[model samples]
Target: MNRRHFLKTGILGAGTILLGNTLSWAGEIKRDVPIFGPDTKTVGGKKHTPFIKAPKKVKAGEWFDVEVEVGHYHPHPNTKKHFIESISLWIDKLEVASAKFKPVQGAPKARFTIRINKPGKATLRAFGYCNIHGLWVSFPTEIEVV
Candidate 1:
């Protein structure tokens, strides 16, 4: 091969190798994105008490009540209401329903009647959020309904 052709081929081969390495490295590594910051405060980080509880075990084919009550302590001074922004209820890997409520006496109540059709262990998870002290905070509580 001529000297000029050899140089051209060498340059092209090096470029291809560089590009391949870069693409492979990018595909092999994953970077995690933070949803909440390090100092992110939840609705009931400390002062805000999550007044919700549920059973971890229950009998199958039985109807049970799963609920969560929240109170916004030290609410924003200018805000009119300190309420849960949203409530997500899930049972047995399925989204059964959703609920919403504003605290009437510093305790907002969200209640749901869960009926178990099959005889097995089920999981009930609830996610809640509210504005406390002018900052948006999330409250997550879960209970088991058998």
Candidate 2:
């Protein structure tokens, strides 16, 4: 075979291998659903934890505001390459509200106004999705209603 042909084939083979590996890596990252808590060992885990600001106790039939944020303790990337895509609020298994974000426009934060007519106990949970990272859920926050 000619030298030029040999070099072209070698380069093409190497590029194909690299592209395959990169695609597999991206697929692996896309499959994970992470749950973050206060005991974050890695900086990423700590930064991904959903920080919820809401009253521990509330009155029945009264409306209240709950704020949710990502990277509360540590800041996450907000650039076009890596950024928080969405933040969602849920009561138990039922989702309450969600906020979407763009690359350079919005932060990973949202405020939800909710009301419970009956006196009972409720659980609040928050979810955040990153452009590079997969889904992340916060530790459950219990609220008392009287």
Candidate 3:
């Protein structure tokens, strides 16, 4: 084969390999975040789903504590092989706070102090990621800001 032809073929082959790997990785990462379904009392749901704790009402422009815990009914494992890796708090589709934990060293919980500038109803959601179980989301909690 000519040197130019060989070089072109090699470059195309490398590019194809890289593209294939990237696509596969993206596909793996696109798994839907799990949430409690019709059977909300399942053990998996209790172990993996995040639970949000906040007051029912708060004054506008005043900071309040929001706590997120990975498990409410049953505690999730925190071993070296499996654990909750991170937790994120979202308010009406906007991420407000996040926390990371090390296996066997940190618990899968976080407290975020935040305030809403305007008086209205605010929706809060929490997401927890586990190393073995992918991602889990909590039910939306609504708080009235006065």
* lDDT leader: 3
Show model 1 residue runs off by greater than 4 Å. 1-51, 72-82, 102-107, 131-146
lDDT of 3 by residue, 100-126 (tens): 999998999899999888899998878
Q: What is candidate 2's CA lDDT for residue 50?
A: 81
Residue 40 lDDT, candidate 2, scale 0-100: 47
- Write down the TM-score of every candidate: 0.46, 0.73, 0.74
Poorest 10 consecutive residues of model 1 by lDDT?
A: 31-40
Model 3 spans with C-alpha error above 4 angstroms: 1-39
Candidate 2 lDDT over residue span 1-146, tens digit each: 78544543554345334333232222323333333343245586667768889999999989999999988878888898878999888776678789999977798988899977778899888878776654566767899999
Total clashing residue pairs per candidate?
Answer: 0, 0, 0
- Which structure among the candidates has the greatest TM-score? 3
- Candidate 2 is scored at a TM of 0.73
In model 1, what are the clashing residue pairs, if there are any?
none
lDDT of each: 0.43, 0.72, 0.74
Clashing residue pairs in candidate 2, if any?
none
- From the highest TM-score down, the ranking of the candidates is 3, 2, 1
